[model samples]
Target chain A: MNFPELMGLAFVGLFLGLMLGSAFYYRNRPAPFVRQIPAFGRVRRAIGLAVEAGSRLHLSLGRGNLISTRSAVAFVGLSILDRIARSAAASDRPPVATSGESTLAILSQDTLHDASKFMGADYDPLRGQLTGLTPFSYAAGAASLIHDEATGASLLLGSFGSEVALITEAGDRTESLTLAGTDNLTGQAVLYATAQEPLIGEETYAGGAYMGAGGMHQASLIAQDIFRWVIILALLVGAVLKLVGVL
Target chain B: MKFPFSVAVAIGIGLITLAGYFLNIPVLQTLRMALIEWATTLAAVALLVGIANLFTIHWNKLTSGKVGGLYSAILIVSLVLTLGVVGWFGPTHTYSKWIFNNVQLPVEGSLLALLAVILVVAGVRLLRLRSSMLSIIFIITAMVILLATGPLFGISVPGLTELRSWIAQVPAMAGARGLLLGIGLGIVAAGLRVLIGSDRPYRG
Candidate 1:
């Protein structure tokens, strides 16, 4: 392999080792406490409020193609979906999940089904919906769905584009709470400006862990923190070396 | 041992795919390609399923005398008519192209325009929503960029253009790269969690 490939492989290996070690060790103990993130707290509160109000909750999983790396962000959305679906199992109005991708739609349906099954109920396939295929199309579809359902809150966590503003605007019109995050830079920027509670940077990926998905999710955060410092240190050292002409 | 079949399958596929990325084995490459193909096919099929679900929901809304029944009816009619027309003719046919160019394109364009307006509104509203030092800085930077994007009534201001470019290229790019690094690590750790079967997002 070339230098870049070799380096990438090494990095991946080191990450895997660190994550596995952390997950194993933390499994038997109380997982590390997650830092305070209001977006996640809003999600939990939104679920509870939607249930109590007997109003619908909208979860917009942006069109993240599963065959690609975008699926990682979409998976985080599904993880949140699983949690909310389970949490609101007994509510009259269950949460509605809208996605741009068909695969995400299916996984969302499966997530709702699993949650329903765990709660001894049947899931409505219509709840986990594929709204549209393209970016704006997805945004337009999800925006309308939000208004149509009279959603009490909107949790937009996925791989959206700048069109995320449309969904957040819908939430604004409805006066509903909006907590949004995405891996797309444009989406993140638009959401930061528009979403009621914006999750910036790595905050979007930390959703599952913050939501208490499982010990593994928490472990992933730990691994991320450690490796992040390692990268920062590497960058700093390289910068210093260059400054000193020591390369 | 009580084995979880689905978990095992997921983990196995994940491992093979992960290995394929780092290793140069012909057998692993072929397996990875096959798995990816299967995934693509499944995604396509899932699209169909998603469409069916959407149709079902609208159908239910129409028949159940819901408040939005008429809109749902119009949507269904439009959907069916478009599908029938497009299917009858090849996707590249004139009729299909006309529908896309005239209908879908315009609708998307309008939404895009609305998005621009909404973003500006949101930007202005940011101060009212949460006035902080960061918000102040964001507004100032945004105003500077917008004003400096072009000359003031065709008069180029000295240094302002350079200032805008520097802000856009330097601070913005740096912040973006920092976020990207964090996002990359997050994806890695999350993917690893799934690969190790500690996180099963697909179980349902």
Candidate 2:
């Protein structure tokens, strides 16, 4: 292997090791305190409101191909959806999911099914829908559903683009609580202008950890902190090395 | 200890894929390609299933006489007709191209135009609704981008172009890169969780 590729492999190996170690160590220990994030607070409130009002909670999983760069964000969306589904499983109107990708839609149904089964509620595959394939089409279909379905709260997470404005506007038209985030920069910018709670950047990925999915989720946060500092150090060193013509 | 069949399969394939990407083994490469092909095929079938679900939804709405049933019926008709044309005449045929050009393109283009308006409206509403420091900054940045890109009355303000380029290439790029780094780390952590079976999302 070449030097750069070797370095890449080493970095990935270290990352994997750190993550696995931290997750294991933290799993047996008391859960660490997670800092308060207002978005997560709003999500908790939305869950309660949905259950009490019998209004549907909606999750808009963006159009991300499953085996691609965007899949991680979509997976995070699934984690959030899993928690939401479990919470709303016994309610009169359980949470619903909409996706632009077929694979995500199928997985969403499976997640909902698992949640409902564990909660002793009947699973309705119809709740997890593949709304549209294209960006604008997905936004249109999801937006109309937001307006028509009596959605109490809408969580827009995954990979989206500037077309997210349509979904956010629809949520606003219904006076629903809309928390949105995406891996795309344009989507984040639009969401900042539109969503009630805009999850910027890594916040979307932090959904599972903040929602208390498990110890592993929390542990991932710990690993992330360490890795972040390491990156900062590397950046500084690299800058110094470049200045000295040593890099 | 035994895992559920689906979970085992998921973990096995995941490991193979990860190994294939990192390791320099011919066998691993072949295995990875095969695994990815299988996954793609599954995804394609899932698309068809998704379409069936979509049809089922609209069909139910039409049958039950729900609100906007007519729209549902129209959607169903368009979907079926388009599928028939594409399947019968082949995707590369003139009819398929005609349908895409005449139908889907206009609709998508209209939506794109609508999105532009919606973004601007949202930005305006944000200023009115929130009126916070962030919103103010957002508007200012947006103004800079717009003004720099399209000079007002074709008048180029001195240094405005350079200032916009600096804002874009420096501060904006830095912030974006930082976010990307965090996102990358988050992806790794999430993937690890799945690989280790710490989270069994596929579990029934």
Candidate 3:
């Protein structure tokens, strides 16, 4: 096999083996504890506050679509949405979900619907919205929704760019508790500046584990961590070898 | 039997796509390309559905005399007008380009420009939100980067340019690469969850 193909196969094998191994390990046993993510604590508090006050919680799914390269981030966002919807299902006003992509908006609706059903609550189709397709339009539309809906807390998660500042700023202006995370570097920087609690880098992918999506979600996170260490070790080894002029 | 048909379909398509990438088989490649085309078409249809959903929701708000009914009306009207114009003149036409340039680009640009002020405001609030050494360092780095990029009366600070380049190239690039690697692994894990039927987003 070619080098690239071999590398791809190795990655796939390692990922699948770790994932399946972890999943099986966690299936019968109790879910392993995930360390507290401070930002996620803020999200939980916001959900509780919204539930208590009868206020709406807003979730911006950002500008990621299912078919795009950002699909993984979008999926992570959806997983978080699922968790939030489950938590907020008992409230009179369920959480409002807005997405920049239509496919994600549709899936958000499904998530809410399923979560509400699981909690024995009615679902509101209007709550899941496609705010805008284009980047700036999406931000502007999401910002307007945050303002108009009078959300108690705005959770910004998914794939976003610098346009995320608009949404976070609006949340700040409205005095809503804003917890934000995105895969984009610029968006992360902007969110760090603007959001009350900002999650950096791969922390965005930790939402499912932090928010108690399921054991499977938590297991996947453990696998990711193990793989991360492996990658770091490999990098260090490569650097040392290069320093020694082994090549 | 508890597994949904949607999950099965997702796994099937995903495997085909993965095999096409790794296996280098001609038939699989052709099928993968066709599947990708189908996926694109599905996305376009979903976009239309999303637009329709937007219209319906806004229309309901307008009819219900909600607080933002006026804005909703404006949005719907603008959407209709823009779509009509594009349909009549075609997207390549000057009129379409003019509408995009005049309306869309300017609005987008204005939002981007607004980010600069927002960044400053956010930087100021960072200390208040999180009183930590890291927060202080973050603020200083941001200030340095801003100053480095800003026009400073034709004056050049010694070591400023080098510092900026080092920060961007070394630390920033390193963090970015790490994040990319983590994100890549996360994606693979999430996809594996789907493939293994442990997580069925499609079931939702």
Candidate 4:
């Protein structure tokens, strides 16, 4: 193999090691260092209410791809999805998830369908609703679904763009409870969403732990906190060095 | 645990890219370019998966015969017909560009226009739902933004242009930037968490 290929192999090794190590590390930790926040409980309550009322729990995996590590927001969104799917399964009413991306959509269908099967429901894999690839088109499809009067509680988690607000705004207009999280930088929609709705921060990845999806999610949150602090420190040092004219 | 060497290579190339960007090194740039080419090749393969998934989905939708089944069939027919025509006729063919310009563009454009109506409805109703100070602030700001953005109003008052520009540029820009920074940090953290394998939603 060439030098570039060799380097690529090493990089993948490092990434996989980091992921697996974090998973196992958190698995072994005693006393659960990650704290379960109240927001997750609220989400749980909303799902419970939807099930009781015979309404649907709407999940949108906002246009996120797992290929890039930069899509942490989407990963957090995925955690929420796991929480919601598990909750929905426990409830009498099943949940419905939607995704715009093919990969995410298929995975969501699989996850939700599996949850239903676990709950002893006749599991027919959900044929996902892929509205469109464009940000606005995806938002429009989600908005239309929410307006269908059958929608109970809507949870949107993923890497969204300016379309995040459109989805949240639609939920607001409807009577459905809405929760959205996105890491799309240029998404003017999220800014609009923040102004109007109750959104969790980047820590939505911890939603599984926060909502008590067992020790796994909690450990993930702990790992995330450590990494976040490291990033902050790095940024601070870089800024300080620039200010001091050291480089 | 065995790993996909291709995926590993793609990620390695990406990391080298980060070093290249930060350090301004020639070697890093060379490595990054090579990595990008590999990624492009992988992407082409991924696109095939996407196309196949789309075809399978539309075919299922067509067979279901429920509400919107016809629409699904229409979508499939359009997609296949367009592809078939393009395959036979080549790029510069009148049919290919015509199909894109007439069918795809209009459908996309109409969806955006509809979003405008949705936005207005959402804005107006947000005011009624909550008489809270924050809701009021949101409503007022939205109205200011809407009016300021309008061509007719902007021409009538020079200050409208300035105010609209400020709403779009200053508060809006700052909020977007802060949100973006937070998101970027979140992405990095998430990537680290994944690398650490703390949260494997993918593992089922």
Candidate 5:
């Protein structure tokens, strides 16, 4: 292979390794997945039903700053958008995406456009709006729009702190089908979300596959699982060796 | 007009952000510097807004003599004093550093230490919370990362540094890159979506 090809292969290998590791870590806790499955199923059903009902789906990228790891998690949410947009395209409706950061605002817009284009559907990017930058302001804004009866389904994914509760509560109040995820450990926020069975920690990584992106994502997730076990074994060995004074 | 304005701003910023990926670009570098300057100004405004919000919330609470009124009063006092001192003398001044080192650092450190304790306790008790193979892997990897990252592991051990370096450089970096690519794609898509008017986040 050429140098670039070699580097590409190496990078792919590393990505797969990390994904396997994460997947393994996630498999340890099945309760969240078990809880998320039915919710996603409901969302899928809602989306299908909404297409017939002429309702739009809502997706939020959260209020995470660009420098944060949560912003990185927002990519997973975008992957979901890719799927949601495609599904919406096949149907009569389109999904609405909202983001807190300027960067994410642009991304949400692009994702919607491209997903539609790739699916051979017509989509106008001007429809996507840039919400407020402040967490509370963004939440309140999103809450107001989503309260509209036309919004049939809601997905809250990405980096969020205590604001998760406010947004999720809004969705709940509207009785919109919602699937939420965040890695933030703020107590009340987490309690509010978990009560609704939101995906936690690494499970947020599964956003792509859950949205039907492709098998490669699932493959990456599986790879993450395997690497996670490898790390565990290494840790156990290291601990045992330390105990025995073999080092 | 609103969506178009936001989309135009987004496309301009996105290009600059992408250009920032490369270490060298005079225009991009200038733009970044300008952006930072603007951001610093905006941040100052945000700080003012936050203070206003705090006072509004607290003053109402104090007038109503709510349960958290005293806490708000204490907060206002502390915030005013700290801001006063820092504004009078720069943050790097001896008195400022003293306050930071003695008061702020300790409080923050104690809070972090408390979190560490809670995490460890929760980790132990919740070890069996999820018995799935994936959960085992996650817990195990987390423990390894935690131990390896801690000073208790003793960096003097042979191969320890190498292993840590390898894990960070190879696996972590790779995963981070893939994630970055995925994020880049999503960002591009979102921007286009906004430009085309498919998703409306600006409407309240």
Candidate 6:
């Protein structure tokens, strides 16, 4: 194999090994406590307040299609939706999930169904709504839902673009506790301005761990941290080697 | 073993797709491509299912006398009208293209244009919401870029262009690259979790 391909294989091996090892360890034992994500605490509080107020919690899964590169981020959003749905299943008003893409909307409904089943609550597929197929329409429909449904908290997560600001701003206007995150840089920047507590960069991917999805999710976060350090070390070593000019 | 038949299928297909990327095997590559095509077709079918779900939700809201039932009615009517027109004239017909260009595009453009004003409002509220050093820096950087890109009342600041380029090229680029690297690593970690049956979101 070429040097680049060899490096890629080595990195893949390292990541898989770390993830599998951590997953196995955590599954056998107890899951470790994930570092506190401030936004998660806010989300928890919002759920509590929504339950008390007999209002709804809204989740916006952005315009990420299931068959595209954005599918990974959409899955991350779905994991968070599962977490939220479980927490909100028993409330007087179940949480509502809105997605721009059709596949994600179906998955969100499935997630809600599973969460409700696990919690012994009746599942209503209507709670998982496909607000709109297009970006602007989706944002408008979601914003309207947040306003009309009396949503106490809006968690904006998924593979959003600049249109994310519309949904986040709507949440802010409605006085809902909004925690926003997306893999899109422009969306992140907009969330920084709009969202009170925004998950930046890779933090969006840690939703499953932060929300206590399972031991596997936590283990994946730990593995990611290890891989990050390895990459940093490799970069430093490469820089030093280049500086020394041993060749 | 907690791994079920579904997990095994997922892992099997995932490995084949991964191999297609790195290995010079024509069969694996073809299989990967075929699987992707299947997924795309499934996604299209899912879109139809979603449209049906949307209709049911709105129809229920309208019938049950929900607060925003009128809006739901409007949505249902609009959707039906658009679908009827498309069905009658086909998607690429002049009427359909006209509706897309004249109605849909304009509304979408308006929303995107509204984003600029919303951004400024958000920027103004940033300090009120969270008076952090980072927020302050973010506001200042945004203002600098906005001002440098436009000549305010026909007055241009000296060196502003160079300053803007430097900021965009250096600090902004570095931050973006860092975010990209983090996202790439996170995607890999998440994918491995799913492939290994460690996190079965699909099962959920």
lDDT agreement with native, every candidate = 0.86, 0.87, 0.85, 0.63, 0.60, 0.85
DockQ, per model, reads 0.78, 0.72, 0.73, 0.22, 0.04, 0.72
Report backbone clashes per prediction. 0, 0, 0, 9, 53, 0
- Where model 1 places Cα greater than 4 Å from the true spot, the runs are B1-3, B150-152
Identify the runs in model 5 with alpha carbons over 4 angstroms from their true place: A1-13, A16-36, A90-92, A120-122, A187-195, A245-247, B1-204
For residues A113-188, write the lDDT of model 6, one tens digit per residue. Answer: 8899989999998888999988888888898888888789998888888888888887888888898888889889
Q: Which stretches of candidate 4 lie over 4 Å from their true place?
A: A1-39, A52-54, A65-70, A90-93, A109-123, A127-129, A143-149, A164-174, A185-209, A213-247, B1-43, B153-155, B164-170
**Residues B87-188 of candidate 1: C-alpha lDDT, one tens digit per residue:** 999799999999999998998999889988998999999889989998889889988998998558988778898999999999999999999999898788
lDDT of 5 by residue, A1-247 (tens): 3576565445444654554454456555542232245656777888788788888888888766654445656766777877888788876668888765656666677788877777888886633444445565456546655764347888877666554455555665676776777545452234222224356445566566566665445545455445445655876799799999996
Q: How well does model 6 score by local distance difference test? A: 0.85
Name the regions of candidate 6 deviating beyond 4 angstroms.
Answer: A1-3, A27-34, A238-247, B1-4
True contacts kept of each: 0.81, 0.68, 0.70, 0.26, 0.00, 0.76
Clash number for candidate 1: 0
lDDT of 4 by residue, A106-155 (tens): 66666666566656665545434555566766776677667753577787
**How much is the lDDT of residue A62 in candidate 2?**
95
Quick one: best lDDT, which candidate?
2
Q: How far out, in Å, is residue A221 in model 3?
A: 1.0
Q: After superposition, how far is residue A90 of candidate 5 from its true place, in Å?
A: 4.7
Chain B TM-score, structure 3:
0.94
**Residues A1-247, model 3: lDDT tens digits:** 5899989988888878877788788888887776678888878888998999999899988887677667777777778888888888898888999989998888888888888888999988888899888998888889998888889999888899988988999998999999888878888888888888888777888788888777777888888888889999999999999999995
Clashing pairs in 4: A18-B195, A18-B196, A19-B195, A19-B196, A19-B197, A22-B196, A23-B197, A76-A205, A162-A187
lDDT (0-100) at residue B56 of candidate 1?
A: 86
Model 6 fnat value = 0.76
Model 6 Cα lDDT, one tens digit per residue, B1-204: 466787788888888877776766799899999988888899889989999998998899899998899999998998998999999999999999988999899999999899999999989889987889999999999989999997689887989889999999999998998898888888887777777776665662
**Pairs with steric clashes in candidate 3:** none
Docking class of 2: medium
The CAPRI-style docking tier of model 4 reads incorrect
